[model samples]
Target: MSLISLLIALGAERHLSSPIWQFNFYYQHYLRLFNRISWINSSKSSASDNDGETATSSVIANTLFIAIPVVACYLIIEALDNSLLYLIVSTLVLIVCFGCIQTRNCYKQYLLAAFRGEPTTCELHHLQLLQDKNLMDMGFGQSLVWLNYRYFIAIMIFFVLFGAPGALAYRLLTKITEQNNTAVESDDIGSDLNKDVAADIQRSELPHAHNQAISVFSQKILFWLDWLPVRAVAFCYMLVGHFSKAMPVWLDDVFNIEKLPHVLLVDVAEASEDFMIEQGDCTAEPCLLVRLAKRTLLLCLAVIALLILTGVLS
Candidate 1:
């Protein structure tokens, strides 16, 4: 069932240039609901607690928010008596959980700008995309590798391991983490504005302590979620790329599973950085990174197919 759903989702994605699930499909609705709840519950201001307390509370709140929907979906799928309907619903859920539509679109635009000799415009767009993925610290070339891991491989592995609920949980965690990172970046901007603006206009609507704690906890949870899958995908990279060059770093970083996926992937991916366009001086790193990632993805698909054929995964 996992293999079948995966094949269907990939097929659907190939035909649709835009992801069937919009970039903000989940986040937009979630934010609206969250704001509504906050408004109704404004009398309770416990969110402004101590750093540790706020962080713990925020983590629990966010985890419950994500897990509720995942459990509901799993229960709904299990309750279905019609096998055909079950397959269709499961396939659609996987499709929605998979793909980084906004990321891919921006990448295409970045490549177009680069090809047109607009380095300034390309770099701006690249930075914007990196910020959206909360990967600005990774730099452009390394961001490409990490994006593949976060948006594709990690989600794929979760689906294969624990089915739709796992995939949904992974996607929700990623979306919420990205949102928190954006908020954290805004807090930095707010600090600069606080220096320049009137005292009344300076203070942010969101409490600093509260927001900071949320960001800290969100980042930690995202790291834990990606730890296992990131290593699994890194191993896939070594298999498809120059193994000798990639393996030593992989071995070293395998112990530090708590580190951000970007740190580990960047070190290893840079080892396979031999691709270059001889005729043009345009950045070919993104292209090469994408090729390497796709090769790893193809190898993953082949493995899944073999497992299905042997009745190891049905």
Candidate 2:
């Protein structure tokens, strides 16, 4: 099921280059609706609570709201046979349906608006939201790992268990867990710091080293998970971005700690296009090479999964 889902997703990517309307009509719409429900529930819980309890209750309510759909999806997938076929067919159908729902004139208007560099309200809102968050200067390798984890690791595992629908369920679970943990940690620290200046002062002394340790720990985990996927994703990004950049910087950062690989790559790439240029520099050619590389990796993963699946079945 997992392999099937991956195959379908990969195929979809090749066929549907810009399925933004499909994504919006199905996935994005549902996510936004769920977020609204979570927000409202949290607000109601907060309103009912006293001063200190409000924060905790709000967090709990939001977490519950986020979890419901994930659990429901998982149960549904587990209860069904041939779930992989169902997932792949349903996903494709939904995408096609969404694409059909958009009039030809609407798509043309969207293209024209995109060409004019006119931002949608959603884009504007997203940009504004990013302004409030702290942007980490995670090295290119680290950034790639994060993306792969979010896009591939979690989804792949869940899909293998049930199918693509299960992948969606896993993503929701992962998102909710991550959000809740972050919120709780932030709240605890914020509350403690608010109460005790002396304690905060003492804790601040080793903040740099503490943060570095956490970064190293995270990078180590990412490196292990991203051992194969990093190369696959980097190639994809290179194809998408049309940059003839080698991931030497990313590889170096993953292998060694001292070098600021991300910054160096950007600097070198800007200075000279020849710096990272390989033979056969055409976009389609490079994309073909990347696709080939990704397919090879996927083949390796498939073999491993087959062994495991065989053992389980036996």
**Please, what is the TM-score per model?**
0.84, 0.43
- Candidate 2 local accuracy as lDDT? 0.40
Q: Deviation in angstroms for 295 in model 2?
A: 7.8
Q: What is candidate 1's lDDT per residue for 74-137, written digit by digit as tens? A: 9999898998888888888888776766677678888888889898888798778777876656
lDDT of 2 by residue, 89-187 (tens): 545532332211122223334335445656473234323222222114432222223333344443554455544455554444433333221212222
- Candidate 1 lDDT score at position 184: 27
Superposed on all Cα atoms, model 1 deviates from the true structure by an RMSD in Å of: 6.1
Worst 10 residues of 1 by lDDT: 196-205
Off by over 4 Å in 1: 17-20, 38-40, 49-53, 183-205, 276-282
